[model samples]
Target chain A: AAGVIQSPRHLIKEKRETATLKCYPIPRHDTVYWYQQGPGQDPQFLISFYEKMQSDKGSIPDRFSAQQFSDYHSELNMSSLELGDSALYFCASSLFGAGGPYMYQETQYFGPGTRLLVL
Target chain B: EDQVTQSPEALRLQEGESSSLNCSYTVSGLRGLFWYRQDPGKGPEFLFTLYSAGEEKEKERLKATLTKKESFLHITAPKPEDSATYLCAVADTGRRALTFGSGTRLQVQP
Candidate 1:
């Protein structure tokens, strides 16, 4: 079975250009999450989607937005990318709403990541 | 505000050396805590999750322990391949988003 998959493993874009990253969740998972990792830093929560709706968002600027379609795939869009937006973007998926204490289905499985460079 | 802090920003250890990394956190309610290992140019891979105080989990040469205020990842006689950044996170407050620490970078030299 294919785990989470992200496209364009590496991307280089000019400032003010829009960048779109895609993610396909596990075969049957229903929740997708996006995270950003800066150099020498830990991954930061960007946003999460469940049942085709956004469940939560972190402290990101308005330039970043995400959408989930059909419960199996998601897309992260950065409009007018800034230099600060250069980072590794990771996509994760897990079973839907399995968020309690004892269930492992809710455990996140991460994709390799998409390295974005803004120049 | 929920926060997670990892100590020693970086560590350099030789093969066969045993050491530990620390993750201290402060949150409103204790939902769960997690540990992940990330190689260069890769995303984090989940290692373990601790739900409450006094919880412990082990995998291979790595052991994770949790307390009310902090968690620790202990490496036993590590190998060079164990070199990677270890991150700790808490999923409780701030809209159920995970608050991560600036990870501990470990370099194991052979």
Candidate 2:
């Protein structure tokens, strides 16, 4: 079974630097979601996209921006990183039953996550 | 604002000990309630999804039950491998994104 895949399983950066994270959603899955989980904290919703369009946004910081491409892959860009930005960034994918006779509720499947550290 | 609260931030049990973790949530027009298991340094693994009050779902040694106000994750005869942080989240009609509760860390000792 195919699952969501995220690039750069680990990342290290310094303050005032920029970083980019990529997500490849599961095949046939139409929705992509991003989350940030700090150490000892629960995963916080960051942003989401459906069909290459921004669908929703959450607690994402002002220095962070994200977009989905026509290929259905998504990228999150962060600039002027802070130490607090160090956390596990997770990308999840789900199917919306788009263009199908079956109507399915949103159910998410998460990737392994990218661990980012700001030094 | 929507809120999800988990109780007893941490728990420890001997192998085969049965216990339950509680997740209480307050949201408008609940679309779905989900349970996930997260290891120390990995992303969450999806467990169960309950759509309405009185709904119940189970997998292996875990069972999840939902009501109008809360949800309970009951682990039966758990093994050490079952130890992990259990997280609960809710998707409301207002947003496609989920609001998560601080997870309950469960440790099963052999």
Candidate 3:
């Protein structure tokens, strides 16, 4: 089965530079989520989108932004990058039912993840 | 805010040794509890989802149980291939995204 796909499996960046990571969700999945896992740390939720609309926000930094397109693919864009932003950035997809009224209550399928190393 | 805490940060077991991992959580609305296996440098692989208290689910040598305040992942028997980080997470009615625990790294020696 085709799983969630993420671009640039590994990324290297200098301070203050900008980066964009893309995700292709499984066919027919309606919701996308982003998470960051620091070395030896737990994964933290960044944000999510449902039906191409921003659905929820977490501890993401102001310099970071993300969007989901009509095709159900999503992107995570980071600007003025700091070294602290270096981590494993991962995306997960699930059937629509995340928020109000439409909670499908399904498990999320995750991508292989993009490792970011900020210098 | 919803949170999850897993115990014994790390565990080591010999092949055929059975054990269990603990996951304690606090959430406003317990939508679902999840278990995932993560290999190094890869994303988490979905394992199980337990929705209600006293619920139990099993696959292969692994079993998951949920209660009002926590969950447990039981590994029966042992194998080197079973070694990996087992993560616990919960989806709350408050949000669509899941709040994950720090995870327990397990190493099975053959």
Give the per-residue lDDT digits (tens) of candidate 1, residues B1-110.
88999987999999999999999999887677889998999878889988878989999999999999999999999999999999898877445467789999999999
- Each candidate's B-chain TM-score, in sequence, is 0.96, 0.98, 0.98
Cα deviation at B98, candidate 1, in Å, is 1.3
**TM-score, structure 3 vs. true:** 0.96
Clashing pairs in 1: none
Expressed as tens digits, the lDDT of each residue in A13-92 for candidate 3 is 99999999999999999999999999998889999998999999999999999999989899999999999999999999
Ranking by DockQ: 3, 2, 1
Of candidate 3 chain B, the 10-residue stretch with the lowest lDDT total is B90-99
| DockQ score of each predicted structure, in the order shown | 0.54, 0.63, 0.75
For candidate 1 chain A, the 10 contiguous residues with the lowest summed lDDT are A97-106
Ranking of predictions according to TM-score: 3, 2, 1
Q: What is the interface root-mean-square deviation of candidate 1?
A: 2.9
* Model 3 regions lying over 4 Å from their true place: A98-104
What's the distance in Å from true for residue B71, model 1?
A: 0.5
Q: Best by DockQ, which number?
A: 3
**C-alpha lDDT values of all predictions:** 0.87, 0.91, 0.93
